[model samples]
Target chain A: MAFDLTLLTGSGFWNPFFWLISIVVALILIYIIYAFGEKGYKRGTQQVKPFISGNPEPSKAGVHVRAGNLYWGYMDALKVYYAGLVPIHSGILTDYLLWLFSVAAILFVLVVLL
Target chain B: MITDFLLHHTPALLVAVPLLGAFLTPIIGRISPIVRKIWVMGTMTLTSAIAVLLVYLVYTRGTFVYVFGALTPGLAIPPDSGGIPIRIIFTVDPMGAFMDLIVAVVGFCVILYSLSGDEKRTGLHYFYTLFLLLITSVLGMVSTGDLFNFFVFIEISSLASAGLVAFSVEQGRAVEAGLKYFMISTMGGIFLLFAIGILYGQYNALNIAMIAERMQFTSLDKIALVLMVVALAMKCGAVPLHFWTPDAYSLAPSTITAMLVVVSQASLYGLFRFVFTLYNLTLNYVTIGWVIIILGVLSMVIGVTMAIPQKDVKRLMAYHAVSQTGYMLLGVGVGLAVLGNQAALDTYGFIAIEGGLFHIINHALYKGLLFLTAGAIIYRIGTRDLNKMGGLGHSMKYTMIFFMIGALAIAGIPPFNGFASKLLIYESVYLFNPLLAIIAMVVSILTLASFVKVFHSIFMGPTLPEYSKVREAPPAMLIGMGILAVLIIAFGFFPQLVVDSLVAPAAHALINQGSYISAILGGA
Candidate 1:
């Protein structure tokens, strides 16, 4: 047996229940588009210069926002995330020893118990 | 089935076909470029087809083993007790076949991609030769019944992968990255050898099943197991040990880089094998699980944070590779933590492990697609800088579409494959520990933000003045991305299919580790 089609798409077309719902959905989509286009037409010609209250929007060209500028607010909120991770230094010999110790402790407990 | 000829030989051929092709490729290449290309594609396709066939056979006939040199089990047909099977073997019992499928599918796509890109100057033939050898080694590592063979295959994969990393000899940074890769991998290899030495001394047997039978969880074995875990962790690019990954991944050609990500994932398979097979933590899972979970959390937090600041898109993806791996570990770790807790194991443990394994498949799909798309961008615009890319959505519309799909998938947005797997992980792990799940959710959101940055910088904004003349990626690259995109959407919508066929078998193999051992030893 191949695909039942009903399970994939819906029940048979004349099943009436879903057919009604489908028509209603299609009508609503068209209505929404029509309503949105009408409103857009009104707004499109209202002669509004780019509204400049105080801070103007940047030019739509050539500005590549760096990570610092992009997340300045968040950066300010979390000032010292690196402090917690500093011990994970790539160059630290002691950090290596600590990792070894932790791994050892965990394995020792597992071997004893399991 | 026992009487069938072809079925009996399929397991051994899975490894042998590619191993033979790896050597045969160079000889064919000397005849003509077309010959080598055709042969390479043919051999990979055949291997992939065989993988599919083997999976089908397993589904039908159950678990099977292929003793090397035709070492028949028992006195007559099936091997009996005390019958010293001197031959090496290939055993496929669900998990091995699944990993084979991953390697073949991903490797095939990568080979197809290499055909599309500009061939490197030095030894294109050797590149494909090593490429096939790498595929063979990965398959062998996943399928070998013997532990020593696993190490041999690892060395093969490591050497071929390093050579591929430095395949572009003109680029000095590629050479440097390859050297770094070799150093770190060799350290991992040494550690692996040390563990093997300890295990061999203890059991006097190298077959995985034989070793598992004799292993008694002694203090020495415990120390060796921990060392093995650490070694495999480094190989898998776990946090704090993942520094070599980003540089090596960024330096290689994108196709090779994508393959390298999957290669690291194979190490996770090794870890899974050890955790479940070598050391069944059905009794004492909490402490071990907590250790893995904590490492996963650290990796999740650190990898994405590092990615956020990376300028090179490949390096950024490489870091995300590390981060996504943390997500997988979180799922598997949560599962491990609650294994013996009957109520927890059935509900949360299974869900978390399944989620993690599902993410493994999903990561290979979207991440592979993303790296390929990044390569497409570089191939077209000739740069890896996210800053220099702007309004690429207009010039490289196809690439943009594919990149957006991959980005959305990786970010764990709903209606994408990433979200489905991640949602499973979140719910299951939340049951295990809500704080861990919340941290995972935060990492998901951060991943979304990072990909959004990528999209805005590369696809939106004005076209860079210099790149106004840039073209879309070649058709073959788009085909590669298109295949992954389809898979991403398909799996997202009908996830139960993947869960049933792929994830269930893999998780089952992990849980039923005894089945793995017994199957290799000619039992179940």
Candidate 2:
């Protein structure tokens, strides 16, 4: 039944069944490639060991990237933006209330004056 | 014999069953735990059945109204003051029925999750009671045709939800969160009440239909509009006014946080009702519409940026909730902006609102699923810190799968319900402004990037020594999350059917003010 359905947007349309077909084709091709490969592959073995330009892999704890470090470069680049943004969320109830009233006042002026 | 009566009084019964059940929950709890669980689930099941039947009836029968205190239940019997009905009314169009369906599905799933998740906590009876009451208020908010009744429902929702937010006595910050929510809600309520009073003063009516029919967009009306806009926007977590959202959402128990998503969208429904129905033709569409668009843009940009840096898993999801709300606002606001121009309205406006309405249901499903998964993780590890989690996919395989489904869906990846709706939004809203659409796409990328970080942190790497013993979430929780996951997948596959059957009629019902007013007052 889904094969007959097409979701129309204002600019274009989407057919999920087509996407499904593509994925199925892609998977079958990959499987065919896998069928011809050597059967000696083993997981978590020396075959899978990392050789990053002849440098040894770090310990597991060091190797496993923490959530903090996952986007460290991104965060560092945006520190100036976040410097002005994160402090807006001061975690103080009074400051939150102040922000609410300030927004309403600005809207009131905009709506009334415009 | 019984079916006809229920079919007739379905709207009233939908709200009444839950309100009565909520009060009776504590008494039933004294009997036995199993009986209480059965009672809560049964109440939600019946309410959901009624909601579905009402939605089906609306699609078939067109819009209808039921007067509470009238001599004839269907007719709007006038008081001695002549021709204007003074009783409370539940006038449900496809728009209201659409909202009711969202409330019903998410409400049942949340109740299912709460049963297993909070069974061991103290004062569990109160938790069920408050949850049922919150369901009652949301149903009432969406269905009521009276402005004053809408305000009453908002107050009831605020009281019940604030209590539930503070119900997690295990969390130290809950009381602070609840207190701040109460203060913020009370302030919003004052503005809403003031707006209602002004409208009642001008039109001599409390029913939204009557007032809408008699609307005069005067200076006073503009004042009331500003008050109502700001109040409802704050309630729904639009930017600069979204300060209370993260605190309230992250501190509530995970199941309750899931339900709170629907509640905030109820406020959004109220905002749409006010702008589209009450001030449809006469008001300045361009100015008011652009105002909403700006609010939505700011909310989308700010909410996601704040979400990317959070270490608390629940808090990050809470920020995403705010971010997602912006998409709905943007789509509908585009519809409103071009409402005056017939050419533009036909070109992209209707699809824009349909996209918004579609996203409302989609967000409720995936966001609810995501929160439940987070709750499952927290229930297992007794912590909310992402820095402290790892290798959960080894043991809690089902929850990991459910979380992946939700995370990908929320990021607007293809083959999920979120992409279907967001696609509608992006393609349609671009016709209005390319910059806004670009901003939305950039937000989607950031959402995906952040979620990749989350998945890698919690599910990848070797199993942590401390968490190696953590098992799967209980069966009831799994079933609850599974309900939403199946829905997300099905909606993904059937976007055309969903849009034609549900979203289009809802957008039509919202934009057609005459029909809403006529359902209560008289002729088309």
Candidate 3:
């Protein structure tokens, strides 16, 4: 009887299940901060030293993975699809309205019977 | 008597009021700079009030027919049975009224934003003039009862918006983008004209209801449907036909770009009016659903993929606009697919349709806010490039917060307005096709990732030396974006408010075809 009551009510907002989640979240956050602090302390002690150039002088590591080139490769692939949509200059405006008229007229006939 | 007049005149007023305002703007602009401000503000405010009144009246009194110059735009309301409706007409249904309310609200915001822009670039008087005309035409397209009237309004809007889009073309690329938009849109308009000619040949009447009455389906019907599908697909920026959208939207002034997003939506409205009201919704017509769904799925997949790589923020937002459109179309396509199924499927269809309609409203809010926020950023930083931007959050805190809110809402994150509507769409589509649902979910996840990237790159990073001098957006732009952000949260937190007030009525309008027919064809 107690189990059944707990199962149903526990699913609601005040469930004991939430306390478990909160404790887990707090522990994870604490762990992350501690790890960051340890990394900083190690760096200060020169235990994890920065890389040096061939001349034995320190220098910043270069960033790679160019973003612009990747985008160009993708665009090149889509060129075929773009080619098919070549804009045709047709100047017939009245014909479009006529199409609208006939289609709307047909539907009106059928739906009005409802 | 007043109710009767409204029933008969609301549609015309929807168009006429804005057109009149557009016309009066030049004269008003001559009086004072403040006069231009007052005219635009007052006209939009009045239109907004009228839209609310029109919506209320539609709910209470059912459908009302407004004849232009006493001419029914479509079917003739004869002195007796079997008489022709001689005048051009405007039909006010619950759906049309809802559209009016949307256009009015967004149109008002655009006008307000325009006020803060550089008057020389905007050409204050002409800007408001074109803006009002655009509003009028959009309202007219939605509310007009005649097929021809819809075309006229479409042209008015297309032409005026094209001008607005290129308004900032002191730069050559902007001009090129505008010209591209014009050429493509002209092609669409021409195709539409051909389709209309075929329709007119079949049925002499130009009024929508009358054509519905008089048209007898033939081989021409199929041809006309195909033509209209192509034409409207181009207009709505469906996957294969959507090329012009990004360039045009990216090149346009930010406020104008926001307004232009609604162009595709209005085209969707036109598509819906065509499909549900003009074509047969029976299962016998499986071809229509297949075509629409295929296009929708393509748009969903392609639009998001394209958005992923875009470095320009406005261009990225433009691609997202296409992807968001895919959501609306997906819902609509699913609804069409399940039209003739039993009550169970019908309920799902209604859910999908209502979800789609509701998403339109949600998209307008967040997307508009997103663009306005983008505008605010551009206003400060003088560029639309994301790579050029970093750590803007420190300088433009409020704008960043609001932009994040909008971005999250658009990504359909839970507890936001986008999520609520998208949830309904996902559930309903899943009921119909699990595969389609999977695709939609994949798209949603990708959308979320893309926006997260935007937020991180633009706001969360360390301050860039270049942007350290930048300040927050002006008060007016901030206020506009802030209002939309609040609406996003409010609607997100309490979806029932929207579901009850807007979605329910719209769903009823679509589902209860009998009510529409009876009201228009004259009582039972």
Q: By DockQ, who's the top model here?
A: 2
Q: Best to worst by DockQ, what's the order?
A: 2, 1, 3
| Model 1: per-residue Cα lDDT over B234-283, one tens digit each | 77778867777787889898998888888888888888787777777533
RMSD of 3: 7.4
Output the lDDT of residue B388, model 1.
Answer: 68
DockQ of model 3, rounded to 2 decimals: 0.06
- Interface residue Cα RMSD of candidate 2 after superposition: 1.8
Q: For candidate 1, write residues A1-114 as lDDT tens digits.
A: 221212111111112235347768989999989887644345546444356585675554536453334655665565588556543545333444455446546655665545
Model 3, B61-157: lDDT tens digits are: 7766666554444343756634555566677788887787778777677667667744446467887788888888888888877787788888888
What does DockQ give for each predicted structure? 0.13, 0.60, 0.06
With a 3 Å backbone cut-off (N, CA, C), the pairs that clash in candidate 2 are none
Model 1 DockQ, alpha carbons vs. true complex: 0.13
Between candidates 1 and 3, the TM-score winner: 1
Report the lDDT of model 1 for residue B408. 86
Model 2 per-residue lDDT tens digits across residues B345-415 = 99998988999899999999999999999999999999888888888888899999999999999999989
Model 3: lDDT of residue B470 = 92
* TM-scores, chain A, per candidate: 0.34, 0.76, 0.25
